[model samples]
Target: MNAIQFITQNTQLDSKSVANTVSLLEEDCTVPFIARYRKERTGNLDELQIGAIVKFKEAFVALEKRKATILKAIEEQDALTPELKSKIEQTVDTTVLEDIYLPFKKSRKTKAEKARKNGLEPLAKIIMAQRTTDLEFTAGKYANANVPDEAAALEGARHIIAEWINERTDIRNQIRTQLEKYAQLETKVIGTKKDDEKAQKYQDYYDWNESLSRCPSHRLLAILRAESEGFIRVKISIDDDRALDSIDRKVIKSNNACADQIAMAVEDAYKRLLLPSLSNEILKQAKEKADEAAIAVFTKNLRQLLLAPPLGEKRILAIDPGFRTGCKLVCLDANGNLLHNETIYPHPPQKQLREASKKIASLVDAYKIEAIAIGNGTASRETENLVKNTPFKRDLEVFVVSEAGASIYSASKIARDEFPNYDVTVRGAVSIGRRLADPLAELVKIDAKSIGVGQYQHDVDQTKLKTALDTVVESCVNSVGVNVNTASESLLSYVSGIGPKLAENIVNHRAENGAFTSREAIKKVPRLGGKAFEQAAGFLRIRDAENPLDDSAVHPESYGIVKQMAKDQGIPLTKIVRNTAVLKNIDLKKYQTETIGLPTLQDILEELEKPGLDRREKAKAFTFDQNIRTIDDLRSGQLLPGIVNNITNFGCFVDVGIKESGLIHVSNLSDSYVSDVNSIVSLHQQVIVKVLEVDIKRKRIQLMLHKG
Candidate 1:
């Protein structure tokens, strides 16, 4: 009907909250802004709830546009009637709306169109009435030069009846319901593709049969991918006899020759028209559901990876490990600025252990390195061992970082701009080092898909995948407030209201005018209007500003409120901040206004309690068991330390100091049924798992979570 009614019906949210959220969205207010700042207006809805409301609002608008297009098309054909127009206007379901307009749709000549042209409409109508027992006489009356004889005329009449049966809304819905609930997806392998090398990955799905409704999303996507690659043929099937019987009861009423004629038309309609169209429609709907599920998995994993523990502001030495190419090393300062670059060969063709050790010790002493990070790639384990054995004057922690998207970032334009004189190896080493210092800032420069944490990423819908990932990145960026003076353009671009162009402008302004002194100084940037500032102010932090509140999450609009709290207590604002004793005793009711409710007041108190606190955990160093180097070394029932690198709906993959990661199926995750894998383990979490089975030939390892 309308935006408010449609969204309310679909979501079952408070109509008033939905109305206010829709209004805020129409005004170009971002989701983070509304969820954080407008608590009183939206009934204190969270980001997820507000995001759902936005989705339904967009769906309602798209539905109305489609209705307008269909209504205009019907009127142009001179087939618009009062009853038909009223039905089309009142319908909300897309499928039902299309069914109402099917009869008037323009198409190429078909059997029904040819039959109507041969003056067989009268004969078809008589058979449909089911009261004409003498169908031969009725058919003879319509016989002409075009029909030739009674048999020919009857055949044409059957074609017209079949089309009428196909166009009936109730009949189509009945068959659609059957397909939706009871259809099975069957696949058969192609004879020539059975032994093909590229087709072996999908061999399990080559000859498979499963209920379409019960099939998992990951399995369905795999089957569809195999069919598309020409390795198998898939068919969606249902009980033909049962479906035909149901349709016969609906169309045939009289026990005579007319009834028999209707029965033949019903079979033709079910076999030739209804089955093919509805089967494809049902398959499309299933694919969409699978895409959404896969996207949800990707979104969750990306968020966890983006907010992974950061080794905050540490001077570090990073290495991109390799064998014959040697290990590429880069030394970075506390702010992640590169100070020195070189190559060291501790293994393989060179075997210059003495020279490599001396270089590392010299760099640590010269650059004041506090930690060492090695890339988990070609020769990760060997490099880690070397770093641990080397004798240094001071104690330094050795960390192994996942180098999933390092190569992609090394060749990117951003990397080129950051390092104009260095080669790709040096750039990659720097990425590894920066990731150890602060993961959120460095990972933002690379693409999410290249991060290597998703399953079936290439097969899912690209547009939907990008939208979901972008929303997650934005949510994570705003939740952990950004430092205005130190954040890169990539990180600043994900702020509440500042997009790519505005982010570039902010960077340029900072370069020319030096660092931002306070929150008010942000307004001086070009084209950053009042609305953008209002949306972006709270999420942007300034360190060591003249006003102490600039570094906190408190919005500029509420600065007066914080000052009032301090003035009423007869103390400076600095004393009230981070003083739990004083902050806990202050009465929040005295500060509440018409626009500011208890929720806003509580948030202000919370911010004052811990100002400019990084919400991420501190990074800790992990060491893999040296005895286990490859899949061949793993033994059954042996427990070892590991880290969760990727997650999916079915299970999670853990790395146990080898190139081939082990799989821990959902069944092995715990004793109880696991509906979600994230509830148990997260990305980059240290876990201990016991080896259940190892297939050396296939390079597969099965692991079970070991609590003890």
Candidate 2:
């Protein structure tokens, strides 16, 4: 199939639309660009469908190329027959194809290859035939009377047959499939030799065993970790009776004597070769399963971090709370502009409390600050109290922002570009402030894994976690349209068709030319081709532009259609946008096509209904208990308000005015069966819980959601 036909078949897209989208995507056109500017060509396929078509096309091409390469390699070795070539061509999955190719793959010497070179071919073939005709007579035929005896001849024959059975790919695969289905995984702890302290964490996993198919991801991961630390050894074994029965049924069912000999050979081969190979395969599969679970947790955490409620476009006084080095203070304007910055010594020798309070008050008054964002790091609570009690604007709200990954971003090149004249500490404070204003935009600039959202994030597969997190970020960023005039280069780069360098170029162009008055002005940005504009223009909003629709997510390409709709309805564009009545009167059937479906038309109508509306809701102020700041302060049955720090597959972690959050296990999330934690709570949500238990020495706290 051609690229267009293949994409349509795989993605379930219309043939014409898929063809047009592929043509545009291949020309380096961005998803947003194709959806917006290339509507006529692509039948108005949206960004998401276009992206899927591109991914499908790429994967299809790669698979086709790999198939060709494998076929060529097999042909060069003179092993490619018509049937084999047809099978290779028909195979779709890479793994199955590789499996079929395994025996033919040239490699270093193996036991089977060594036996073949030892002049035992005829003897091996007789043994494989499993003839019932007198075993001694058959054996004597291959015996070299001067060089080898009957017993020696039999031993050599058995070795050769064992090698042959092991090398038979079909038999090996059959046994492997049976073993995988019926295997029991066994784990044994390595006995500690008195002085070994390294194995303490894995002591509980010393004798753990479970069925291969039923083991939990976390439990499997824990066992693997134990093995890695030399605290345990894990092995998977299949029932020998069942395995032997399968082999006998396949090769020696009718002849009793033949069955016995074949069974013995099969047992020998499994013990010497297949068992170890299958063990490694099971372990590999387990590791992948564990990695997928870890990635899922990290992905959820990343999504929560990205979607954390924005503080809106308000002037903020951000303080990176510190005691010894003093707190880093920064003032950001409504549009995230760094208005002023300073260091405040509110704790220690510079404990000039009056002076510090006066400095903060002056800055707040000068900048007309609407809120105070304090980094939830060292001495954060003290800083919050200091700001709250100080003589500043009475209406200014103080919020404790999670400062995770702030340090990473401060030292990044993006930070250096955004604040060339400022120090890293100052830049971090600004980031903290901006994060409160627009969490999705600012957090995208930092590595999602470093944002400190999930459990054991550092121990997971870095590449897989990064790919999943990047997808989540991309989805969230695109879901929320960006402002062309106000978005930072970091946020703009995530826009469809824009990368870091291109984003920088766009920013540089803006800097050189001033604020963009319309989306069309982006065409002037260096290296930004027409394809990029087509994908990116619709999502780039220009507030207060000459065209009112530019402020909405309505694409410029749709401007004419909307204008026509308005004119046909005997209403102006502005009137049609504000009054839903006019839109309700227009006939949407006229806009339907292969590219612009009813979905697109409905979305356009909705955008017109609510022009320039902020999709994100305002985050409410949270209340945390003042008395319970650490585990030592927590007491049983004490009721306290806290913030839901994170929600996981297992439970929710609540930061109930304590250094270490307490987990409300899935069982305890509700009186009823709460299968999913997300159904109950989300990240950064305020919740009330009662301290069910606390061990001050162990630094552990147990919380109960029922109290709330």
Candidate 3:
């Protein structure tokens, strides 16, 4: 049907909201802009709902384009009929459209084409009609030079009938429905790959059989991966007798010899054409389903990790721990500017504990370090102990930060531009420190896939994954307003409308003209037009702006509303913006205009309550049990503290003071049944788990929730 009708049929969203959202999308309004600013027009649709509408509309448009191409092709062949054109135009499903186009599709010479060339059409028609007639007599009527005898004519006729059965839309659709409900996936290991080390990782999938419709996404992806790598052969199968019966019922009419010949043609069509084509189609559909599920999981984990608690602006010392290479250290100021860098060896090769301790103390005193952030990598536990034991001038909060993509960031082009003279080690240390101070700001510089908190990140569709992760990053960045004065180009890139090019322009403008004094100054950046300004102004906060509302989530377009409210209340704008008591009593209905609704006004009131408030929680220092340092140190039934590092459909991976993170399966996430792993545990949640099984040989550990 139409875009609106298609989207409404697929989604449970309000038809009016979907229509408005589709209209705004057609006008090229971004999702964030509509969700945040145009509440009145979209019926207060959130970004997620708006995004879904845009997705569904795009899918429908693509289907329409494909339909147009097919209709034109069939018409060019002089084979298009009025009824067929109506079917193609009215239908939205791609599979149905393809089936209707199959007969007209040009292909190389096949048995059906050859049979028609051999004057066997009359015999094929006899078979198709399934009338009370003698097959030899019907075949004799078509016998010619191409068809030498009655038997030869009968064979060619059967081939033509087989093709006709294959092209019928009703029969194909019936077979597809059966496959969707009953198809099973089976994998058999290649004899030569059984002993290969890489193949061993997928041993569980070898000789596996499961219902394709019921298999978990992770398991399906894993099996598909193994099959792709030549470790196994995956096949989709169903009851052959039932499939033959389905085609038979669709074609066979009379209980005679002609009907028996039609039945044989159905079997031939299934064996030669229909079965292979539909099996591949079903596999592609299953793989796409698995990809979507994996991408959703990846996006959720990335969102939680990006929005993890931040340890607000503070001078800090960060360490990248190592055994043979010494711990690389850097001191950063409150703004995350690198102030000092050094290297100290306190473990293994050097073991100069006193010397390293004195160096750290001196650096802390000299730089006025408020916190210490250590990377949880090789020798992380030992370095943490050393830092905690060392005497300093003030009480310092020590944090063990995940160093998943620190090295990638260190060697990145952004890092090179930011710190041209610093080495990778120094840049890595700085990243660890900055991530603790602000995760969204620091992690934006690194690729989400490289951040290493996903399931099947590499296996999913790359385009879909990138789009999803980019959306998540944008959401988190906009959720927490950026400081226009001090945010780096990388952090500014994720702002609602100011993408990479504009973010760099903003950084250059700031460099040339000094810090932005007001939100208005942003429009002066090169190539940042009015539309970009409208989309990004509210999310960019100026701490000491001339206009008090500029520092909050209130958009510039609504500044007059706030000022009017202040004038009506007989108070200065500055005082009224933060005066909770006055804001509480204000009647928001008085300000409702043609453009502004209750939803937008409610958001403005909330912003006034807590201006420029960070949505993330405050970072707290977490410590693993002192007794546990390595896998060798873990014992069964010992309770220990851990952080959920990565979550998958099956379970979460927790770091419990060892290089090998332990698995807490979905079953053990709590005392109750957990259908969803994320509902129970977040990316960085602190949990108390008891060691269940630790296999030192495999470097694997199993953990369960601590009862106490």
Winning candidate number (lDDT) = 1
lDDT by residue (657-691, candidate 1, tens digit) is 99999999999999999999999989889999999
Q: Put the candidates in TM-score order, highest first.
A: 1, 3, 2
In model 1, where do residues sit more than 4 Å from their true spots?
none
Q: Give the least accurate 10-residue stretch of model 2, judged by summed lDDT.
A: 106-115
> Local distance difference test, per candidate?
0.92, 0.77, 0.91
Q: Positional deviation of 352 in candidate 1, in angstroms?
A: 2.0
| 10 residues in a row with least lDDT, candidate 3 | 132-141
Inter-residue clash pairs, candidate 1:
none
Give me the runs in candidate 3 sitting further than 4 Å from their true place: 140-148
lDDT of 1: 0.92
lDDT string, candidate 2, 493-607, tens digits: 8887777888889888988899899888889999998867877777788888887898887877778888888888887777787687677877888977655666667778888
Which 10 residues in a row give candidate 1 its minimum summed lDDT?
Answer: 104-113
Per-prediction backbone clash count: 0, 7, 0
TM-score for model 3? 0.97
Number of the candidate with higher lDDT, 1 or 2: 1
Any idea how many clashes model 1 has?
A: 0
